[model samples]
Target: METVFIVAAVIIALLLLSLVLVKQGHIGVVTRFGKYHRMMSPGIHFKFPFIDNVFNKISIQHRSIELEFEAISLDQASVNFKSLILFSAKNSDEDTIKKIAFRFIDEKSFMQTLIRSIEGSIRAFVATKRQSEILVLRQEIVDAVKDHLEDSLNHWGFHLLDLQINDISFDEAIMRSMSQVVSSNNMKAAAENEAQAQYLIKTRAAEAEARSIRVKAEAERDALELKGVGNALFREQVATGLAKAGTIMDAGAVDPALMLYTQWLDTMKNVAAHSHGNILSFDGSNDGFDKTFKQMQLINKSLLEKNTH
Candidate 1:
C-alpha cells in the first residue's frame, strides 16, 4: 500500500509541473533543452515534463512609452524633445514569435536598441536642419525616424505603430531670443498703428479748423457790407431833417443861433444819459471818429468867438 501511494504522488507532481497556463494578451515561447520548440497561446498548455522550458512570454498588445532626449541642430543649437512611441508584436506567426523570443538577451536589451535607433535617426535628420526649421518639420522628423526604424523593429518581431513628437524646445537662451524677436515685431506693428491713428486725428482737426475759419471770414464780409449800406442811409436822413429844420426856423424869423444852442444842449443831455460809464473812446480812424473830431473843433471855435464878442 505505501509503494502504490508513493508512485501516484510522483506522477501527480510531474503532471502539475508539465502544465503551463499562459495569461490573456500574451504569447508564450517554449524551448526544448535550450533550443526553440513551439509557441503557446493564452490558456492552459501542456509540454514535455522537465524538458521544455517556457522561455519568455511576449505581449501582442500595444505598448507605449514616452521618451525625452536632446539633440543638436545644423547650426549647433541644443534642441530638447519629448516624444511618445507605440509598438507591438509584429504578428502571432511562428517566425515572428520565434524572433521575438530570441532577438536579444532580454526585454531591457531590446528596448534599449529600439530607443537608440529612434534617437539616432532623429539626430541624423536634425543634423541637416537649422534651428528655425525644426518646429515646422515635426512630421518630417517622425517620418524619417519611422522609415529608419521600421525594418529594424520588424526583424525583432515588433511593429512601429506610431511615433509622436509631443514637445520640441530650445535651450533657455535660444527660447528667450526667439520670444524677444516676436515681441519686437508685435511692438513695431503697434507703434505703426498708433502713428497712423494720431496722423488721422490731427488731419481731421486741421481740416475742421480750416473750414471754421473760412465760414467766419465769409460771415464778417457779409456783415461789413450791410453795415456800409446802413451808414449811408442814416447820413442821408440826418442831412434832410437838418435842412427842413433850418428852412422852418428862417421862415418864422427865429434866431438860428438860439436854435443851434438848444440843439447842442439837447445832444449833450442825450450823450450823458445813454453813454456807458459816461466815457467814450473814439476809434481814431478817418472813417467816423476823425470827422466827428473836426466838427467838434469848429463848434469850439464858434463858441469861443461868441463869448469874446
Candidate 2:
C-alpha cells in the first residue's frame, strides 16, 4: 500500500508540472533539455513533464517608450529632441517568436539595443543637417530613421510601428538670435508694405492732378475759339454800317468826307466816355490829324466806288 500511494503522488506531481497556462496577449516558448521544442498559443498548453521548460513568455502586444537625446548638427550646434517610439513584435509566428526570444539575453538587453540603435540612427541623420533645418525636417528625420532601422528592427523580430519627434530645441542663445532675426524680417516686410501703399497713393494723386490740368486746358482753348468767332462777326457788322452810312450821305448832297469825319469824332467821344483807367494815346501833331482825315476820306471813296459798281 505504501508503494502504491507513493507512485500515485508522483503521477499527480508530474501532471501538475505538465500543465502550462499562457494568458491573453502572450505566447510561450518551450525548450526540451535546453533545446527549442515548440511554441504555445495563449491558452492551456500540455507539455512533457520534467522534460520541457517554459523558457520565456513573450508578450506580442504593442508597447511604447519615450526617448530624450541630444545630437550635434552639421553646423556643430547642439540640438535636443524629445521623441516617442511605438513598437511591437513582427508577428506571433514561430520564426518571429524565435528571433524575439533569442536575439538578446534578456528584455533589458533588447531594450538597451533598441534605444541605442534609435539614438545612433537619429544622430547620424542630425550630423548631416544644419541647425536651422532641424525643425522643418521632422518628418524627413522620421522617414530616414525608419528607412535606416527597418532591417535592423526586423532582424530583432520587432517592427517600428511609429516614430514621433515631438519637440526640437536649441540652446538659449541660439533661440534668442533666431527670434531676433524673425522680428527683423517681419519689420522689413511691414515697412515695404507701407512704402508700397504710399507710392500707390501718390501715383493716384498725380494722375488725378494731371487729368484736371488737361481738362482745364481744353476748356480754355474752346473759350478762346468762341471769343475769336464773336470778334470776327462784330468786325463784319461794323464794315456794313460804314458802307450804308456813306451811301446815305452821298445821296443827301452832303460830302461823304463830312460823314466819315463825323463818325470818327463820335467813335473818339464814345471811347473817352467808356475808358475806365486805360490810356488812349495817339500822335497829337498836325501830321497825325491830316493822316486821320485822309484815311477817313479814303474809306468814304471806297464805299462810293462799291455802290457805283
Candidate 3:
C-alpha cells in the first residue's frame, strides 16, 4: 500500500509539470538537454517532466521600433535621420520558428544586429548622395536599405514590413545657407516678372501713340485735299461769269470801257464794306480814276476781241 501511494504521488507531480499553456501570438520552443527538440503551438501540451523545457517563447506578431542616427553625405555634410521600422517574424511555420529560436542568443543581440544592419545600409546609400539631395530622397533611402537588408533579414527569419523616415535635417549652417539660396531664387523670379510686365506696358503705350499719330496725319491729308478742290471750283465759276458778261456787253453794243469802269467801282464798294478798320489808299480824283480805268479798258477790249474771234 505504501509503494502504491508513493507511485501515485510521483505520477501526479509529473502530470502537473508536463502541462504547458502557450499564449496566443507566441510559439513555444521546446528543448531537451539544452538542445532544440520541437515547437509547441498555443494551448495545452504534454512533455516529459524535468527533461523537456520551454527554451524560448517567440512572438510571431508584428513589432515596431524607432531609430535615430546620423549619416555623412558625399559632400561631407552631416545629416540626421529619424525613422520607424516595422518588422515581424517571417511566419509561424516550423522552419521559420526554428530559425528565430536558434539564430540569436537573446532579443538584445537580435535587436542590435537588426539596427546596425539598417544603419549600415542607410549610411552606404547616403554616402553616395550629396547633402542637397538627401531631404528629397527619403523614400529612396528606405527602399535602398530594404533591398539591401531583405536577404539578410530572411536569413534571420524576419521580414521588414515598412520603413518610414519621419524627419531629415542638416546641420545649422547648412540649413541657413539653404534658406538664403531659396530667398534669392524667389527674389530673382519676382524681378524677372516685374521687368516683363513693364516691357509689356511700354510696348502697348508705344503702339497706341503710333496709332494716334497715324490718325492725325490722315485727317490733315483729307482736309488739304478738300481745300484744294474748293479753290478749283471757285476759280472756274468766276471765269465763267466774266466770259458771259463780256458776251452781253458786245451784243448790246456797249463800250468795253464802260464795263471796265463799272467793275472798278464795284470792287471799291466791296473793299469798303468788308474792310476791318483799314483805310483804302486809292486815288479818288477823276483824272486818277480815268488813268486806272483806261488801263483796265484796254485789257478788257483785247480779251473781248479774242473771245469773238
Q: lDDT per residue, candidate 1, 1-309, as tens digits?
A: 999999999999999999999999999999999999889999999998989999998899999989999999999999999999999998999999888889899999988988888888999999999999999999999999989888998889899999999999999999999999999999999999999999999999999999999999999999999899899999888756655765687699864555555666578678878877757544556666546555655664575466469
Better of 1 and 3 by TM-score: 3
Q: RMSD to the native, candidate 1?
A: 9.6
Screening candidate 2 with a backbone cut-off below 3 angstroms (N, C-alpha, C), the clashing residue pairs are none
- Summing lDDT over every window of 10 consecutive residues in candidate 2, give the lowest-scoring window: 242-251
List lDDT for all candidates, in order.
0.87, 0.91, 0.90
In terms of lDDT, the poorest run of 10 residues in model 3 is 254-263
| Model 1 lDDT, residue 7, Cα | 98
| Candidate 3: C-alpha RMSD after superposition | 5.8
List ranges where model 1 is wrong by over 4 Å. 196-309
Instruction: Give per-model TM-scores.
Output: 0.63, 0.68, 0.66
Better of 1 and 3 by lDDT: 3
lDDT of 2 by residue, 151-215 (tens): 89899998989999999999999999999999999999999999999999999999999999999
Model 1 per-residue lDDT at 71: 95
lDDT accuracy of residue 13 in candidate 2: 90
The TM-score of candidate 2 is: 0.68
